[model samples]
Target: MIIGIDPGQSGGIAGIDGDASYAVPMPLIGKDIDGHKIAAQLKSLTPDVVIIEKVHAMPKQGVSSTFKFGMGFGIVIGVCEALGIPYRLVTPQAWKKAVLAGTTKDKDAAIAFVRRAYPSIDLTPGRKRVPHDGMADAVCLAEYGRQIMGNISEVS
Candidate 1:
């Protein structure tokens, strides 16, 4: 299985195994990441490799928020390392360019792309009206990894 993570409170993690895929929002406790929960998920997934979205603080973000975001990102990396899972970082631009292609580089575009790409999966959870853009991006990131990795058995 290949895992992809979008690190932030609003972000999500996705696991893709062949034609199957699963996603969940980043686990959080208050403003901090729930590392234990994340670790549990990673353990269960037993990913062969992980793909994390390379992110940085935005120009206009507050210091406190930026620090919190950084902390979450760190937790993700730490969990992957603790599990001994190989991982790669892909920038939002690069993944979008590869997976999203001709579509607009925006949340809505990603959502639409996933809707078309994975029609079997339910992007919208609970009773919410809209699809989760974070989940969509996570899936796209996984797709990007899968595309680059090609056939895993042939990689060696």
Candidate 2:
């Protein structure tokens, strides 16, 4: 299994195979919260590898949000490390282009492309759409990792 994470001020986790998937939006925890909560959730999924959305320095308008996101990301990394699960960090543009090939430079267009590509997935319909962006992005990362690994036997 591949576990993909879209870190936010409030983080999200998604587990995916070619056809199977699960997503959850997790509340942000202060430094006081037990890191084991994340580890436990991930452990329950039995992920073989982890894909983390790389943290970047966003524009000033997003500075505070990005900072909190980074903290959450660190927790994710630590959990993955402790579990000895190998991980890779993928940039937003890289992940977006990989999943939204031939459709870049426009965020809305990329989102639309993902929705169109994975029509069977509940990525952008009704109230589910609210969490779709982050969840879909994580799914994209998982799919990308599967593609790179070049085999579905394990995923299946």
Candidate 3:
């Protein structure tokens, strides 16, 4: 099984376990980054491979926000190490380029991509039907894992 995570406070995670596949919000502690709980969730999945989005400091970002993002990134990496789980890193550019090229692929594009890739998956809620970019991004991340590290399959 392959587990994919986008390591951001507003990000999402996706994984395949046994015969099920799920894409959901990244588990976190109330308002803080909680590496232990994240690790526990990953451990329970018993994934053979874990792939995380490789991100960096972008321009025009404030110091505090940048610091928090970096800290969260490190925490996720540290949790993987502590559990001795094998992981692979994929940059956002690399993955996005592989799936979408020569276009300004924004959140909406990501949602569309996931919908196209998994036409059967239900991505929206009942009332609002709001588009979920985080979930879409996580789905794409999992697909990137399949591209680079063959043999992982989506849930049926």
Global lDDT of each model? Answer: 0.84, 0.67, 0.76
Q: Highest lDDT: give the candidate number.
A: 1
Clashes of each: 0, 0, 0
Query: If scored against the real structure, what TM-score would every candidate get?
Result: 0.92, 0.75, 0.83
Instruction: Write one digit per residue (lDDT tens) for candidate 2, span 1-156.
Output: 888787664445777765777666543456322467778988788887888888766676587666665767787889889988888888777666666677653546544654665556565444663535666666677766666666433321
Better of 2 and 3 by lDDT: 3
lDDT score of residue 108 within candidate 2: 61
Model 3: lDDT equals 0.76
Where is model 3 poorest over a 10-residue stretch in terms of lDDT? 147-156
Show model 2 residue runs off by greater than 4 Å.
30-34, 61-66, 105-110, 117-120, 123-131, 151-156
Candidate 3 lDDT for residue 133? 75
Summarize candidate 1's per-residue lDDT along 1-156 as a digit string, tens digits.
Answer: 988888888888888898998887778888678989989998988888888898899999999999988988998999988888888887898889888888888999888887888776667777767888888888888888888886443221
Pull out the clashing pairs in model 2: none
What candidate 3 gets wrong by more than 4 Å, as runs, is 17-19, 101-104, 119-129, 151-156
Which lDDT value does model 1 have at 149? 85
Better of 1 and 3 by lDDT: 1
